[model samples]
Target: MAQNSYRRPAALLAYEVSWEDLDGAETEVSPPKLVEQVDVPATDQLELMNALWDAVTFDAPWVPETSEPLRLVGHEGAKSTHYELVLVGPSVAGGSSPIMTDPRFAGEHDAWDDIALDKSVDLFLDQILVPLVEVYGLGNMAQLDAARLSKMRERVRLIYDKHLMGLGVYLKAGPTGYVQGMKFVLQEMVENSAYRLDMANMIRDALGESAQNKVSIDALEARLTARASATAILAVVQAVLVGTDVGKVMYDLSASWPEVAWSAVSAPALFALSPSEGVVTRDESSVKFTVLPKGATSGNYRYRWTTTGDYGLLSDLLLPDAKVLDTREREVWYFHNSPANIQDTDRDNVSVEVFEVPEGATSIPAGAKPIARMAALVRGDTRVIDPRLEVNSGATPADMYDSGETYPCVEMLLRFPRDPKAYGYVVSIVGMGGVGDPRNPNYHFRTGNGNVDYRMDNKIGVNVSDYRGTCAWYNGFFGGDPADWPATEPDEIMGSGGYDASNETMLLMLFSAVDYDDDEDLGAEADLWKEWARGATFEVFPLYPEDAR
Candidate 1:
């Protein structure tokens, strides 16, 4: 034919050789068999056969770079990428078919592109080959132990002695050579081997138990990573409101109320209706209440209280959870003026109103005590203080009618458009001078009492300056006339300098101009409070990141 082009070698087919028959005698005649030749297109047939033999016997592939093991074709002339093989069928004696199965082609073949030959070989050897070898070795050991238990025990003693030497507890046989001395060592060695087997069994059982428990551990991890509950959000609100140092409540729901559901009810609600609505009657040990307006169409109401108790005890109102209204920051307004007037200047005679009722009661009961009312009234007859007067537009001077003295007090009202999807908060603040009030512990030392003066860094109650930007600013008077106030702008003031978003109780800020002396006075100190009342403003808006939530 052509020049021997198959340079790579081909492996000898198992069918190429004859084996012993059932009689245990080697057969001399050639058997009827199918043989394959290597398909590598080598010009030399002998060289191709040699390469195939080496690949199978020594585990080296024909192409070392590609690392693909050679495969045999049925015929000598079968073509491959760079080789060809021949398929031949030689007749044996008595015309029998092939007897032995081919073990060479038993394992799975690798895919063309992603195969890493070395790694695949390593995996096959470790996962399959080593296990198979260990199984065969264990079988042989079992047979040996069955036949020679006494000898195996002796072997274990020897192994124990070797190990003992490594552990620095070896006992060598002395020249006296007492056989009794070695009996204890043999017993210890045998026990050690038994202990090893027990330990291995224990380890295997632990692994199996861990595998069984894996499902539960995975589920718990998933639950921990899921979205937090509504109770968590409520806790965040409490933390912002009532902790100690900064005074925002902090408690983990997992530890504090583990049994509570996410949507469970909070503390009970206490109510206080306008007084003119009805009258309250006394019940035995409990308060019975009712409301009566003066006229049906007049909208005027009056409340009569008959509950017999010390009014001071009513300070901690008791009512159920359902009675409280969901007003967001509007709740601040109800408590603002009801408890006590925060704007009073007199230190010693400061007065506050305390109420006592059921924990969840919605309306204020008649006959309930309203104790401790102190009035250091700021303007008195000099300036008229309209409590609920609404401010719509423009800079207008509120009339101050005290002893014929008239000073102008400017008021501002802000209204925000309602958002259906977003939660909103409104913050109101009054300005103060650089020196904080000596009486208040929450004072910040940095800012001045001006419309524009603001505080910077703030944390908790540690320093004076820090409190400026925190809660509602009601410390002292700001300095500015309405004309001095920015006319073109919304007259809104930034709280970062003193009043901050974190301490904002409510969204609305109500401002008033007050005369320092009984007469409508215009001294420089009076000007300061007057200016503050006239021109001061606060910012109000939503707090959290809407998109993120």
Candidate 2:
């Protein structure tokens, strides 16, 4: 919206101070002095002319029908002073006396008409213009920018229209009804004055430091509230008396007031995670977590883990004999025995048993060895182990065991330590040799052809929880016709496998260690084995709950 251009012909009103003698003769004490010059849009021309006439004809009561002028009575050494007003403007050729005959006046002249006109002018100056001038200079309404002034005027017009233009209720009720409607508008403005001022200051601050101190919030609020009430009351009264639109009058008047600036609201900051570390039970059905920067009281937040894929391996917790092996082809833990080879007939004859020993045990369980003695080989890719034992049975008679113990056997006992942190563990044993010699073709026994057999056994402790079922062990002999062997590939043949147990107290695997057949015929004598132990590898994972996303 554009700013109002208050351009029009200017009118000058001058007044002379005078005193009257007791005989009813008047004498001028001072020459006429300029009071004010007024200019307004063409729409307001008639109103301005009427006010000028009233100010100039204020002495009408003293002029009686008999054509005798009344004298001013003196009191306590002071004489009453009278003001004789003269208006010079385009509408008035000689003075304001001609205004009564102007067609714009549109009424029969009478003594009371002069009196009411005089009062209207007095109210306009004393109640409306004076208060506004005290806060802002005359014709300096530009202090309020065009857009802001337009908005303020729109608000005033809205209130006036809503309350006053109700099916002509105020028209039927007269001036009193219009006054009451204006009072409702004034009440709302007064109540919201403080809030509007605060909003204005916020806008000023956002504009930068220079605009912040342009006006004081408290002072501007007080002045504007008082001035608005006074101007609004006079505007309503004039509207009722002159049959003009109260909304337009208020809209026009608001353009001369200071602007209350405004701005848009900013967005909120990002939220933060509540707990630094998150932990959940292994194989738990659900996840629990918290996030913050909680907004309004009714607001809620969602959470999620940003990282993906399997949980990271706990490298530090890996056993001393175990080494993490990561390559383009595979990722696993390669466990090796201290002495890769154990030779002794007595060691081979006895069944191999593996067990986990507690930290403070006073005495070792009979025939039970420290779990560290049994090296563990764990595959990181599948996170499970497949143990297998292979034996060659078709070698010559001299190559076979003399005791007739056809199969080697091994036994293991696994126990969980206090407060175990891993989700589960895997243990596997792979062997491929037995008493046999393939070179003695004539002495071949039991279908000969150097037949090889495989088997596996696994057991879980009672304390274990959430046990995933075991996988089948591959079974077949290497010797018979290649087509007669197991349908699966030879190298893929494995023992009982793939069990997941949480909080496991103990586990056992039973098997016998036997010598490999002399297939190469190197003639190297088999060394005796006293105590035999191989490295055992394990893959452990800690459980974590899923994210809430």
Candidate 3:
């Protein structure tokens, strides 16, 4: 059991545009832009790259992709050519803040690859502007100095702004996913002193001639979401795309949030790089399931334990895969190999990889068909799953905001079995029905989804909001009860959503929230997905109606 590290984007393809082409007007500057692409070395920006990768994979909370109100915005082929690249946003060339307009019209090659965190600044200095010096007949310089640096900064500042200057030219808007890629850049730039906002400058620019007058609430309020505001935010994005210090983009944008003109400030909680359908694959030797230890501290830790699904002489055999309810520090099991695929229970009856079926038996051992599984397109994380009922823990109701509750929880992605040959069963709901989720029950809860806290029988003493700022998500049973939720009742934890027939079995993702109060059942999430995948492993002795009493 080795630590699961985050993977960075394998490469970067940079595209530069001429000053004329970028601005949408004619200019004499030739060789003004050349696509000087380079592969970003993973080691260069380990932290930044991992974070960005997390965002794209949906493992991170903020960076999410949105589908807008489906409508065509004329033809984009005429605007973006192979040689040209545009910095897209809400209102491209429209009035006011073109940079913040809309991004619907942007073609594939139109975006500037500002994906480089601090490395972007280097790209600007070394590749973008440096090449221009020799080509423009400008005097060649040996090294960069204070004066030269300032000049270069100023020179490219305009170029960068114009890159996204007025792309809002065809701003067709949407409800969310508006600020599509800004969050990744923000996540990387936030802590660094380099990417800071200049509030004083923004104030000066906004007040204009009225700067001398005592600042009035009206003035501040007006500028909050006005064109100038968008300008300031986009300016920061431009600067950061070039490696400038944290600019006023995020700060300015926050003041006017829920109305930032475009883009979702946050995305639903999901495993970074997780698939949208919750589809997963697990054979015997190597399992490729992905889990996000929601509340666990950030670190490189190993997942060590045997899964009952591995065909072992262990307890909890009824479970397709159940990690021995264990923890670290005290006597623990194996810290052996890198986290890989789960052992396939289906094959156990015939030929298996990690686990073996007994001889003379055409199918699995008695009282077992295969592990029951369900498909799900589950997302979001839960915070602290307080194992204790501390008076203060329940003091705070619950911060069931959009995706914030997913913080500090565990993410498990598993498959629900659907094979009539091995075991026939349907996954259904229990506990908190659609009336509402115990944590954040609302009419919108079932707008397009359903979940049940099957093993949530101990609801009497548990507070809605645990000791932590958030409440435990009782939407699943991976962290189900052992005494109350006996191993026999896999059906008790089955989801209400039936197995999808058109496609193969889908994944059953369980984000079992962890508790700051205890660590005994800490390793549950890892253990669950590692073992479960067979269609009907867990079953009632009389699985087939009158087969047993």
Residues 1-549 of candidate 3: C-alpha lDDT, one tens digit per residue: 001011111122323332223346533223323333333221121112221211222222212212211111112322322232222211112233332233432343233323322233333222323322211111121122222333444544544353323322211222122233332222322332222222212222323243225444344333332422445445544544344211222222222211111211111222221111111122222222222323322432222223333232112223233434211211112111212422211111011111123443433344442211111121122212211111111111123333222222233323343444423333333222233334321222233243332221112112110111212223223344422321211112222212223444432323233333323222233333322221112221113434334
lDDT of 2: 0.26
- Which stretches in model 2 have alpha-carbon errors above 4 Å? 1-142, 147-151, 155-172, 192-213, 224-549
TM-score of each predicted structure versus truth: 0.15, 0.16, 0.20
Give me the overall lDDT of model 3.
0.26
Error of 1 at 9 (Å): 99
Top-down TM-score ranking: 3, 2, 1
How accurate locally, in lDDT, is each candidate? 0.24, 0.26, 0.26
Q: Which candidate achieves the best TM-score against the true structure?
A: 3
Ranking by lDDT: 2, 3, 1
Instruction: Return the lDDT, model 2, position 288.
Output: 19
What lDDT score goes with residue 219 in model 1? Answer: 38
Residues 373-458 of candidate 1: C-alpha lDDT, one tens digit per residue: 11111110112222222222111121112232222222222223333343333344444333454421122222444333222222
